[model samples]
Target chain A: MLKLRWIALFLSLLLGACSQHVVLSDDFPEPIISQLPQPVVVYISPELRRYVHRHEPEQGADWTIVFGSSQEKLFKSVFAGMFEEVSLVFEEKAIPDDALVLTPVMRDFQFSTPGMSKSDYYEVWIKYSLKLARGGGEPMLNWAFTAYGREEKSGRSAAGAMREASRRAMRDAAAAIVLNFMKQPAAKKLFSVAPAAKAERT
Target chain B: MRCWPAAFALLLTAILGGCVSSSVEQLRQAPVGVLKEGETIVVLGRRQNFRHQTEADFTRCVQNTLTRKKLPVKAEQDFMDEMFPWFQPRMAPTTAEALAKRLQEPAIADRLKQTGTRYIVWLDGITRRGEDGGSLSCSVGAGGGACLGLLWWEDDAEYEAVIWDMQTLKSMGKIAVEASGTSYVPAVIIPIPLVAPTQSAACRGVANQIGEFLTKAIQ
Candidate 1:
């Protein structure tokens, strides 16, 4: 009996040593087109540019937490659903005469896991800051939003949970940005006014 | 003795998987100062593109906690409207530096000055349910019915408080609070579930920390 118990322990330990990979995918909620407003150009600052790359395995165990895809691309995908016309860029560009600009900053991202558990879980948190302005006007709005996600160790592979948490956190942040932007009077006023007639129309 | 191996695995898991885990860090400290009696402070949740109930709850929790500590703290009912009347559904300065500059603009500065708000506390964070799985099936025969299955999942909560001194137009400090735990629902013949106190734990922990931090700052 003692020998069998020892063998089981050894096998569990060996299996635990193996590492797994997880990816952070985008999950933006469906949009309400009528509710969404004017087109805006999006710019990402260099500071918020890193893809989620973190590995905090349980003590003496092997597992990795990796976020797949350029975080810049993932961010662009998020805002695409919120605006009628949208453009994303990493490098700074001069604002077009008739365009509104949005600058997003990835303030912080954190991930942590327990050293050991019957079920292994992962936690994620992200902080975001946004600046909005017209082509020539001083920035009218500046704000920050924070979102968090967790993968509870469960039936699916632990990797699935990790991925789910990352996606959810991103979605939460995106949702906050869209909702708050719509609430702003400036946003409302801008969108509320119908666009000018095309030059050719006359 | 024959089941010793299985029991060992269970024991190891329990020992390693601790209960509700949490921590708080002070990113920046409030400058040297003291709030005189009758001075006012306002707690608010940053309005985001979408509504975040946790922000409101956290704002209330912090305000109530601070008030209990003898600090005159309250939440502005129409903070967004009052502070940025011309621009609702608008943007706000994200960094302390940007905010300091924005507040310097005469319109915003005058409005805030009239309110006499000494400190502005912004509460932000998230709490969510993790993945869940399990299946159940039941059949009713001529005589009786039978069922079987199990379901389980985990939950987590994290929050941070950013404090700003209106007069100085600089960040007083920031405190981040976090908590997470697992829960289970099992069924051999019946289902049983263990609930996790993720958000409440974070709330309580953060509230206590803010209280303590303010008390110390006053002394």
Candidate 2:
């Protein structure tokens, strides 16, 4: 009976060692960009703020990754720094008149492990879709971008590596937003070109 | 008992008997100048290349080595955060000229001044495994276990440091280090691996030269 108990304990320990859980709640630094000379409304949806990912490896136990409030913090820091005046809104109707409304949706999240990829790296990729409109009207510009991050398996735990890779992926997404926002022609039309239309909206 | 102690010492020496060789070269474009008070240097790893990216640990290792050698270096992450999207992988300047032109922006220029950044060292390159040969095998029985074989491999590490004077908006010079070595593992009932410190030797070589280059006041 004691031998059987020892075997069971060893099996359970082996199973426990294969499971991993990661929670990301860290804050993103405020981006440094020339503030848009217009008022902006950032809408953070519940789906984006509280995202969770779960996956099971080939021979290991389940892996759960909880995004927590990182998405909310990222959008907050990004839009607040990009616009002169900023307001956080949950609903579309609460947007102010003549202000630009930016809404982001978490489209897809994927990750690959070293064992899976036959590489010595843990990688994370995040896809985001952004909707841009004026005063909660029809969407003037719709765009989707993917961001990626990778970390080498340099003696870090599975969960620790995944967490760092996820944060880098989020930061990469934020960079995509700040660096590519002004490059869109439709976006440029709304943010820069239409003085008369902007005056009316104001 | 004395023989046992001598055998243990021999084993210890064998475990640390890794062989490594290194070379360092530098090219200075302008006269070496002295650092001003309240000035800080930033050692940043360049990641624009898709084929090879400078290892983050190596970058930090250089930073730590420089610190131990008494050179002031700002934390790369903090410096990148303060610069924000400007220094992100997608937006960061690839060339010294591009960096100088980007510094012309008032906001970026002011941030550089506010952060008291005088020099920016960009680390680029990767440590990769070279040709390797040999293998080992092990076998076990109910009463005993024993293995006998030999394994060996080679490692190559090459890195370059491009120094840019942020204050003058000029390329100060470049420093390159190359290091290579072979590792061995011989098994006689037990495997005694002799690992090479090729990457570490390259890191130290670059860091020590950087220390000498920055500290000297030839201007």
Candidate 3:
């Protein structure tokens, strides 16, 4: 009995040292923006809904970070505030007629711990690619951007700090998209009204 | 009273070694105006700089101190949630001029009014520890355990707050604080710490000045 118990403990310790996994929660808040009067549709992809970052180094613990459902929630909340009428479609075929379509994909995810960086902070970097198109499959624009986040390790556990850093990186990406999207020439042409034309109309 | 002796002892010890020296200043750029009923203020800290990020606890201290002084203060997290990306670290305006431009946006302006926020204080700065020149050693044996030697360091805290009157979309004033102190840990058999509360002292000084400044601004 004693030998069996010792063997069980050793195996459990070995398993514990081999891998680490984390599931992230949603951290996005609905943004405040000047709403476009036009109706818009967002296509949420299955790949994004099941996005997971797996890291396996040569001599370190394997890490897996699951961002399930968080990305979809973020786009839903963000687009809800950006348009007068917003619709979410899980399938590409479900997009309605003549609606502006926005699709976002997670391109890459990377992170560094205190042990790796030799600093008292945990950092995460995320890359995103966003596409805007018409429901009829005509592409308007594609924008790629990167976001960085860092959290201090003073009073937080390693996992907690890394999770927070990841959330902050997502918010950074959201902020970038919100701040610059409307300023893009394509989007500007879509949303802006000429002052002379407006005056004439009024 | 017994309290007198304890207070005197504390003052003497602070005078002798571990004590904080602090200063506060305010720069008025425009005349103060009424804060008005239902209007509140928010203290926000900057985090965009790569070199340093303001301590979260320090900002909380400022908010709590302001609240303790009976000033109408809004929780920064709630305010930021309502404001969202506009007040994010990457999107937040660092200057009053930029803030004025942002306020021109109808949506943001409406959100600000809905939150009943009339004053926005941009707070920034950091605390640093340096000048370490001491050693502490401890040992335990069958006979007994003892610790001998001394460890000492210096800490400095500096902060600044830029006050903007959102109602007028102009900066009302600015407040600055600088505090420094030395902390010592000496051990004979055990460690005796004479620590300086430098950060808290700066927090109190800045909060006091802001409270007074806002009170005077009230019409």
On residues A95-142, what C-alpha lDDT tens digit does candidate 2 reach at each position? 877878898989999999998899988999999989998877888888
Interface RMSD of each: 13.3, 7.5, 7.1
Question: Could you give candidate 1's fraction of true interface contacts?
Answer: 0.00
Q: Write the per-residue lDDT of candidate 2 for residues B1-219, one digit (tens) a residue.
A: 345544654575476467999999999888666777778888988765244678988899889987886667899988988888677776777765677676666677778888888888888888889988778889999967756677888999999998878777777888999999888876666677788999899999999888888876312
What's the TM-score of each model vs. the native? 0.44, 0.88, 0.81
Q: For candidate 1, write residues B60-144 as lDDT tens digits.
A: 6667778888776755554443552221212444444555665666556565666666677767777778777767666778866
- Cα lDDT tens digits for candidate 3, B1-219: 545545554554455567789999999898767777889999888767255678888889999998887888999988888888777778776655676777666667777887789888888888999688789999999978877677888999999988888777777888999999888776666666889899999999999988888876554
Candidate 3 has a DockQ of: 0.38
> What DockQ does candidate 1 score?
0.02
**Fnat per model, in the order given?**
0.00, 0.49, 0.71
List DockQ for all candidates. Answer: 0.02, 0.38, 0.38
